[model samples]
Target: MSNIRHHPKTETLAAFAAGRLDEARAVVIATHAAICTECAQAIEEFETVGGAFLEDAEPVALRDDALENVLRRADPGVNVVTPQKPAGDLPETRLPLSAYLEGSIDDVAWRAVAPGLSQSVLKAEGYRPGVLRLLKIAPGVRMPRHSHKGEELTVILRGAYKDEIGDFAVGDLADLDAGDTHTPEAIGDEPCICLIAAAAPLRFKTVLGRIVQPFIGL
Candidate 1:
């Protein structure tokens, strides 16, 4: 049995395996799958099924430049990044996310969003109507109650938090859609840091959240 209590839904995982998810959301799933055996196995199964479908499909002529395009994309210099050690109290970041950071997680330039909360927004080329960011919450800090407009994927990197849905720890992924809503609060002595990918703007329930939402861009 795995220790992780939260994971992406089957439909979400299937989209990830099929390469249909945007880069912002795909990074979250990949990072979770890196530490979660169950999700990883499920993703492998989906890939196998997809492969079977591909094998049965009719072959099509490829563009003359397709081979060159593939080789260029596959080149290590263009697509590969070596992993580095995390500094200070930050948890080890998996490969999918490590490629984006310049150094350790501690080195990230975080901007204060609210009391006891800080965030660092990440840029994803061609990703629209969505945002990927890292949020660090101090222990006992409660995030605003809110629901999603489209979909949201969050993976814990360090410490833990509790919400209406359930308690979340390191490697746990909270996969939520428009219908789900919750306010999460950091629980442990250490700060709770998570990588979040939101497909659309969040719907804040409280006046404070609404007022602050524009500034924080959550």
Candidate 2:
């Protein structure tokens, strides 16, 4: 975590602190914040500022039935079960993210998308118009050059990779937006594994990548 050289942009963290980001993108931001001290501090600062702003805002009157409705929702006998946090140590999947996974990184059931490339799409509610997935690239493998239609957030979880943008290792988050294009190549001895939250589908540049796009659904 100490060597992390990349982080989400300030505006992205601000959106997260304000609870404005979509669930899938928020998960990626939270996962990165758990490991990166700098990003965590930045998020905290944003939260603190947001809290101050809220405190200064004018108050609005609530409906006469609001308090009664709240008490009814808070009743333990309502039969709604609140999810308990996972106990003890977390797996390599890390906090927040660990809650979303069945097990550690090695336990992922991957589907091969291309030679030396595998992926596992994560399912969760409230991620419409976007997707969350884990990608594993074998050492020496290079992803096809591509650009985004919207935003793409990628956090390295295992091994490392290098692209036109820069090198990325564990805990480093690459925050890219529309028009950004690069071909990432796994750089270490091991395969590079990353968690990605994409707002829209990628636009592959090469003919081979275009042909394979439908099959991979990336």
| Candidate closest to the true structure, highest TM-score | 2
- List residue ranges in candidate 2 displaced over 4 A: 64-93, 125-128
lDDT at 45 for candidate 2?
A: 97
Q: Number of clashes in model 2?
A: 0
lDDT of 2 by residue, 1-218 (tens): 58899899999999999988887888899999989989999999999999999999999999999999998988988768776664545446456777777777778999999999999999844646668899999999999999999999999989999999899999999999888998999998999999999988999999999999998878
RMSD of each: 3.9, 2.4
Across 1-218, the per-residue lDDT of candidate 1 in tens digits comes to 38999999999999999988988899899999989989999999999999999999999989999999999889988675764565434445445787677666778899998898899988864445667889999999998999988899999988999999899999999999876899999998999999999888789999999999988867
Which candidate tops lDDT?
Answer: 2
Pairs with backbone N, CA or C atoms under 3 Å apart (clashes), candidate 2: none
Give the TM-scores of the predictions, in the order they appear.
Answer: 0.85, 0.89
lDDT of each: 0.88, 0.89
